[model samples]
Target: MENFNTDLDIAIIGGGAAGFFAAINIAEQNPNLTIAILERGKTGLQKVKISGGGRCNVTHAEFIPSELVTNYPRGEKELLGPFHTFMTGDTIAWFEERGIELKIEEDGRMFPVSNSSQTIIDCFINEAKKHHVKVLYNHSVKSISTEAYGFTLKTNQEDIFCKKLIIATGSNPKIWNLLSDLGHTIVAPVPSLFTFDIKDERIKDIPGVVAKDVEVKVLETDLESEGPLLVTHVGMSAPAILKLSAFGAVELARLDYNFKIAINFICHDGEQCMDALKTIKQDFAKKTVSNSTQFNLPKRLWKKLVIASNINETERWADLNKNQLEALVDQLTNAVFKVTGKSTFKEEFVTAGGIDLKEINFKTFESKRIPNLYFAGEVINVDAVTGGFNFQNAWTSAYIVSQSINS
Candidate 1:
């Protein structure tokens, strides 16, 4: 750990979304104050470069703060105040003011109109340059110490002294480890935004078949999500599954990623399915069971349903008695599949746990226990479901921390 002091007003660790945003806000507010961003990696904004498959989902278009914060599974309650201060609409406006136009997808995820993550990346870099914020890449901080008037950041390259310190390292174990050394509790880290691995023959071949609407219910938990479901080569995926995976990240890990998932392909209840099945059976009584399905499921899936239901493909619908109809209804409403493992959905992946939210004040993102020490972004125990919620957290936390920093 080299110790070389460079006096500054604020020393921000991590140069990802949160760190850069904080730097921009602080520099814009206090132009005379010196600010530097220390990044461990060679390049900053690695996540931003890869998010939304390089298009960079900046934020969701949802303007309602309460509704927006609800997507966060961990820090929803704490984010209420910060979001009220700087919400998604503000994020769009902020970028727009910087000459970056954002387009909202049909799903409500907002991204740069250029349709490339480089646009967003360049915007941040240009903004940082315009604000005179110095970003030092590959300068990893080894430790941070707080003095009466300021903080000292010991890094691999050099030691820096700053009046205010902000940790925006995103969701890395090493970052939380540093925080723990600084006297802060950390919530155990777990994987979020993953795809379930189902060892089922039904969806093995139809890996790309996506249902526009689906309802996923964990067999033993109250966890569920209603949205699009995708068939993967290994099992199932999609927005609905990804959301459920986020909410049950810890629980699923506890179970060793082994659980039974009930997938309602049609997004209907048992009674609705039963009623629909009865009508279909009556209309197609003379047709082969394999030819007529209870719902408008894909033809490719009908074969698998017949085999899984233990009904003969050649059997006529008339041969299907009340028990068979009930069985078919059950299958339609609650198609059970064994989830054996998990797969990474890198486009929207994020960690579930981080610095305990209680240790940091939501109003300013400053540590209550350590004065002048603050945190922002995924580095804290805050995570949200897919669709740009994570990026919103980064922006909101950075804005709060920037406003709190003294000039």
Candidate 2:
């Protein structure tokens, strides 16, 4: 392959999910356009290789644009119209047209039937090659400067010029600094989609116990979520906690990772739990309180809660006095724990801040402040909860950018 006839028609920064997708789609549609992807790493699509535990969750099973947009805590309102354009259905069709099939899990996350991220990466690489998209590796952009006709990107290797530019670098501080210098507002980035780190007597020594359909609330804040909760060696995780983390990313960051959360293990009302405990005391009079699990809770978790309520392991249900019964109810319905810190959810490190959303036009994913410049993925202050929502945003925004750039 030649170096190029002249300057590139399009230059995409970052070789990750959004950059690769936008480059491939744009070049596929405009085969005559000269485009190149500047990747800092030796290879591109590193995030795609590790996303969704290496299976690469492509998109969610959600069909409705409005319903799907709700998964994005930051871009919920902005992504509604874009999802209508190239959403989950369009993503599936695009992959299927390329001879790749995706399967939906019970949790609604869609992954390749092969259950490997390599499939998606291979497709992107092949598609880019077919469209003559040059993938330049080890070309980290040192800075970005605008030209009268286009933009100049100063990289470690050399200076590359392009008439149109797209910044797809996700959660990059240097890139953000460049954008900030170019008169764009960058909201300070904070960690998102992380698991809480906790140490408590109730959850000690029980790592894999799961309580389905539990309610979790960040104490003293409006943050609340409910779903299946998993007791990890550190603290609690799963959907219930993940949802809270995504939605409260900014607020939790303000708290300096030190906050208290009240969890309802049973997802039952206080009065209702009390009534049921009394009924259980009468029905299972001879059964040991810690031995009999109720409300579909895991036995180990039930025993922990029972012990935390000041009930002995051998204490029978009939022996729970009124105060003890109340304590048990409180333990089940309003158990509070201290979250000391947070751990990145798997290898997925998502940030809740980026270029201010108002700077970009959602219609074309092009920068309103800088004409012919665009942004996609986590670079645009848009992020979603786990379960394939983040990838969906990538597809939607990159597709829109592709379409717009082609025109």
Candidate 3:
């Protein structure tokens, strides 16, 4: 491997979203400051290329920083201020200024109009080049040494020195270990933003069935989430399940990924659901109970619940006994599913733990233990549920870091 010693103003130790954003903004702020991004992979932005199924969800459409911060399960308090400096609206304008327009989906996720992650990658590449930010790919960091006034980073390709350094390495264990050795606390990482693996006859063959509104609660715990729930081939997914997965990551990990979850398909309690069903039976007495769907639920899903409630396809609403009606309400309002395991959600994988939030100053995204050392993105102990919130954290923290370094 080629080896060299060089001194620079700043060195960023990742080439992902936060690294590129910080490098470009910092370089643009101070043209005289030399900057380099050291990436371990042969190509950088691999996550960005695959995020949001290759469309590259840049950020969410939530304009208010205070409201946007709520999406983050870990960094909600710490991110409020940083988001005030830079958030979704700023992100949209940033890309638009670079000649790339973003369009917001119905779910509030913003993506480039080109509908390709390549658009995002190209923008980062051009911005880095335009600002003279050197990107060194395949430069795996081996160690970090601190000097009286600066830091010396030893990588596979070369050893470099810099007055200021930024670690945006996402959830890499090696980098977290390095930070730990440098007197920083590294929070134990756990998988976040995943799907629950479930095996239940009610959802067996209805892979694509979706409940427009639901409330999923983890049995024996206070963990719960409300949103749209999707029945997947492996188990349950979508915002409702994903939100619980993210918020309860630490707790569920302790459970060994085996637990029970209660799902309220119609956002109603058991008593309320039963009353609604009674009213439905009275109104549709002549109709087949299995053929009638209440609460605006999909027909396929209604049939599953009906069968699971011991009501046959030919059972008329008028024949429904009190026991049968109660069973149907129970299935609709308090359906319980056994979560056997967990599965990562495509390339949107995120970790709930990282450099402990206490180690860094939220004002500047700088490490409190080490001056001029900053962090951004998943490298910090901040992660959000599925959606564009995770990317927003990266942008907000990175922008603040750039501003701090520029000052």
How do the predictions measure up, each by TM-score?
A: 0.94, 0.98, 0.97
- lDDT of candidate 3 over 104-187, digit per residue (tens): 899999899999999999999999999988888899999998999999999888789999999998999999999899999988
Error of 2 at 55 (Å): 0.7
Model 1 residue 22 lDDT score: 94
The segments of candidate 2 whose C-alpha lies over 4 angstroms from its true place after superposition are: 1-6
Superior by TM-score: candidate 1 or candidate 3? 3
Residue-level lDDT tens digits of model 2 in 158-257:
8888999999998899999999999999999999898999999999999998888999999999999999998898988899999999999999999998
Q: Give one digit per residue, the lDDT tens place, for model 1 in 1-407.
A: 33334898888899999999999999998899888899898899989999988999999989998898779888878998888899988998899898999998999999899999999889899999999898888898887777889988887787788988888988778777877887899999889889998877777787788777778889998888889888888888888898888999899889889999988888788888778777777888789888765456777677677767777889887777777767776677788999999998664568899888878888888898899888989988999888889999999899988888743
RMSD of each: 2.2, 1.2, 1.4
The whole-model lDDT of each prediction reads 0.85, 0.91, 0.91
Where's the lowest-lDDT run of ten residues in candidate 1? 1-10
The alpha-carbon deviation from the true structure for residue 332 of candidate 1, after best TM-score superposition, in angstroms, is 0.4
lDDT at 352 for candidate 3?
A: 92
